[model samples]
Target: MTSSLPLLLLALCSLSAAEAQLTVFNLRASDLPSGIVVTTDGYVKVFCGSASLGETSVRNNDPNPWWEEKFTYFQGQENDVLRLEVHDSDIFFNDLLGVCQRQINFMREHDCFLESGGLLHYSYTLNGNNQ
Candidate 1:
């Protein structure tokens, strides 16, 4: 609506114009709960706010699975929170394994977050978040 233009402008004005990039290097899980008959097929998905960055391929049969996949997201803001979810892929329904979340601006150059059932390893170049 026309009434929202000024507010939008204000919000945009508050945002830093410099570029930023976040790189998720990999994710790994250990001791994932296995179904009675089968081992877990685990995967991971990442999000910046409500926007999905990408997901990893399922690694089958191993509770200690490492996905050395990389994902890059650009133009991050100060308030953006990075979220990662671990899941067990199943035939009927996927099970939620764990979740990790942290503010993008508060992260170090290289850090790991201990999720409920896993760990997310990531790094970011947050030159723009200084504003």
Candidate 2:
């Protein structure tokens, strides 16, 4: 086993790590409930595993919120899964409205349906990781 140690080191050193970027496009939602408020102040908190990509701005007083905001993360893997959480913003604490998750893909759009009865219209692009 000791004789092959040098060869193993050479092989390991030759491997190149892949780097990619993930871009989350605009998001739109419908039927979001008001959480202890007169209207629903909705926003999105994005995550890939423990890393937070970014979030959109809060859209106030609307059951249907359309945020034409985009967020980007530079260290995305093709096998990585994303957690898209919809929340109702408030003064003290933010209320979770819905959640949906999906594996990274090379598709053009992702029409996600939140588990708590709503529609999420968003898309993403993964670039520079060989698709």
Candidate 3:
């Protein structure tokens, strides 16, 4: 029927190009307006290019901090872009509290992605995809 619908839409675009499972949950930061206090234990750094898939565990003097991070990737494509950086845990200098990105096919077609900086709120979860 209609040439088998172009081979079933190329087998559903090759099963939506598989490989996924990116969970970073409950990472919070609320009610802010206190600047110029650099060095108060804070962490969150996840990148998916040049490989540095790890971070989070430095929450002292927390400003609504709660990092439940998890990451896994296996040949992730669709212009992979999941880079988040929010740091304040400094011994000499490490204060960068802003940065967000999302483009693993738009987090696997809106499976998950809620990124924010400055009063942080970054929760991205896309479990199951491959491309």
Candidate 4:
């Protein structure tokens, strides 16, 4: 077992180095419900598996908000699902606006919008393998 230990270690290291890139762009929403005449701070949380790639800044008081924020993350497996959750930020607790999910393989160069209670438009694209 010891004789093959070095080769096994090398293979594992190379596997970890194999990576892909995920880009999220042009997130905007309109026709949102104005609640109680209060400012709605809308933001998004993006996740691939358990790893969070962070979120966009809150757009205060704008029901029709455009967040052209771009984010990059270490891509998961091709079949893994990417989850996006939109929320309204509040002082005490935040309200969930919507939830969306898409497979990583289908995200590339495709428009992914989640509109149930509100309107949201965004796109995801994948870059070549990064090693």
Give the Cα error of residue 39 in candidate 4, in Å.
4.1
Which run of 10 residues does model 3 get worst, by summed lDDT? 108-117
Give per-residue CA lDDT, model 3, range 76-100, as digits (tens). Answer: 5556777767777766887776666
Q: Which stretches of candidate 4 lie over 4 Å from their true place?
A: 1-17, 107-116
Residue 96 lDDT, candidate 4, scale 0-100: 83
Query: Mind giving the per-residue lDDT tens digits that candidate 2 earns over 93-112?
Result: 98888887888876657667
TM-scores of all models?
Answer: 0.71, 0.79, 0.33, 0.75
Judge candidate 1 against the unseen true structure and give its global Cα lDDT, from 0 to 1: 0.73
Cα RMSD for candidates in order: 6.8, 4.7, 10.8, 4.4
The C-alpha lDDT values of all candidates are 0.73, 0.80, 0.62, 0.74
Check candidate 3 and list the clashing pairs.
Answer: 17-130, 17-131, 18-129, 18-130, 19-129, 19-130
lDDT of 3 at 77: 58
Best by TM-score: 2
Residue-level lDDT for 31 in candidate 3 = 37
Report the C-alpha lDDT of model 1 over 10-128, residue by residue, as the tens digit.
88876646556766664666677787899989888888888888999999998878887877777566768888888889989998877778887665543344444445455555544
Looking at model 1, the pairs that clash are none
The lDDT ranking, best first, is: 2, 4, 1, 3
Candidate 1: deviation at residue 30, Å?
1.7
Runs off by more than 4 Å, candidate 1: 1-16, 109-131
> How many backbone overlaps does candidate 2 show?
0
Candidate 3: where is the Cα deviation over 4 Å? 16-21, 26-40, 50-92, 95-126, 129-131
